[model samples]
Target: MAPRAGGLYVGKMVRFTSVGLRYAPPAGSSDPGMGQDVLSDLSFELPAGSFHWLLGPSGAGKSSLLKLMQLAQRPSRGEMEVLGVITSRARRGELPALRRRIGVVFQDFRLLPHLSAFDNIALPLRIAGRAELALRADVTEMLRWVGLEPKAESLPPELSGGEQQRIAIARAVVMRPALLLADEPTGNLDAVQSRRVLSLLQEMHRMGTTVVVATHSESLVNAYPGPALRLADGRLER
Candidate 1:
């Protein structure tokens, strides 16, 4: 597709037009790019049902960019449309549903320490108020998909880092979100475990979910080459 204004299409899985996000909220100033911004004058597009790598060094606004894509933070200036919703102008009450359609996997594997693996993967379904019996079977299948079926009863603290990360992936995809974002998902795993996690993410992309993975691992980038959006010193480099 040919580019539109700001080099972004009108409707995509993700779109940013002259977007800038600051260290603090826009605070009714209307022009957020004027502040000391973490991401300044960024503009790009992630097409529906496509996978892309977010490549950048540490402190290069990678995390900050993902935060915007996932609607965790609003674009302080310019426009952002994620999952078909213009999040910058979306009402506060309307964002929850949009967020539910997006999944996020973090570097720390933010599983609840108190919850068992089964419950942890089931958390999203439970939050959406699914029937208890149905959600159990779904969660169980997810555990098997991630090769963590045996750890269903294990707590996060009891599981190895690899196991915990797998559980996190399962939880992130349990709802079959339209878009998935991962922040250094393989950062804590060994080479073998990293391969496993990356495969799961690739599988998700193959199933038609738009995916973006942020990573600093050169080895990972080499192993799984794809179209990438690179950041440098708070600006898009590609």
Candidate 2:
């Protein structure tokens, strides 16, 4: 179901206006060009401090949509506006500054294999030049929130799939970006673990981060019971 618009509030803090995208096959490929389009004139509005789900079958272009939001890929056509800032003609330097206000968790759990979980979570803080004392406190609190405090010093290789997923989440949210994108965050987790992970996300939303999570799990969708932007054949199905 689409989220009801009017009652939420006027002058909402986030919006996505008429976004579009496409992807080509990688080099050295024998596959014929089929004019495949990954996204088509997608438009959605996300209010600040809200949670939205992007749900669809595999290969429905959920991840592609997210990359567009993150400005990792330019749109084939149309516009995406973030916090009233239009993206179409944005400079390369402008992107990084904009991205600092966003958080992302990919399906593969992109944690550094050589770094311990604590260091991984602190990466964003360190990059932003946060002080050592503040970094330590924030990173430690994030690990504890994700129930990974005991394994804070463990490298990614030493953790199970669920633990690694938690670490990825902790890293993504450490800086508390304005927008949070989680792609199939609980895909590898069991029911109990999935709930725990979802709860962590919910806690973030309560603290006013606009969140969008893409998942195919029906049970998880129902459990959270939020509006979903359903994608089909690489386009949003209204």
Candidate 3:
């Protein structure tokens, strides 16, 4: 079933109007191809507390769009609003706070190899200056939610791909972000693992976190259909 929004808000969480992105050349360089558009004239909105699929084939500029949404790259042209902050118009100093309200899961399962599962999940809270005792409780609850409480002291290398991904997901949401993004989250998992990961994501959406998932698997989409933003050649075709 397609995940439904929890009515957490009455408006959009993301808005892109005529957005374009071009990788700029290095200083003092004038190569003709240096500034070509990677994404052009894109417009879309992700409603607050809703779930969305970012659908497209490779080289379709999906990653570029994700980058823009994550505040990792500002659009070269047009307005881009994420979590209510229009990057082009916002001050440079305001981004970090906004970033904290967002969470991301990567396909590669970027958990720190040396850190214990508990420590990896606890890292973000530690960085945020969360009290050690309070964060311990939070991390414990996350491990329980992912059914990994027994594996807490294990390192990433000692766990299965699905477990590692779960740890990554746990880490991503440790702060309980308002917006959550997953880029090919099930790309590295088997059918069972993939379904488990998808379930966790859907649960997050149900809890009122605005979620966007970018993936190439049609079967996965068919399995859990949702509203989507389709892209082709860097444009929002739907």
The best candidate by TM-score is 3
Model 2 Cα lDDT, one tens digit per residue, 154-196? 9999999889988998998998787789999998888887888
Clashing pairs in 1: none
Residue 113's lDDT within candidate 2 is 97
- Using Cα atoms with residue i matched to residue i, what is each candidate's TM-score against the true structure? 0.91, 0.90, 0.92
For residue 84, model 1's alpha carbon misses the true position, in angstroms, by 0.9
- The local lDDT score (0 to 100) that residue 161 gets in candidate 2 is 84
Better model by TM-score: candidate 1 vs candidate 2:
1
Count clashes in each candidate, considering only residues at least 3 apart in sequence or on different chains. 0, 0, 0
Point out the worst 10-residue segment of candidate 2 by lDDT. 1-10
Model 1 residue 125 CA deviation (Å) reads: 0.4
TM-score result, candidate 1 = 0.91
Every candidate's CA RMSD: 5.5, 4.5, 3.9
Name the TM-score of candidate 2. 0.90
Model 2 clashing residue pairs (backbone): none
Regions of model 3 farther than 4 Å from truth: 1-10, 26-34
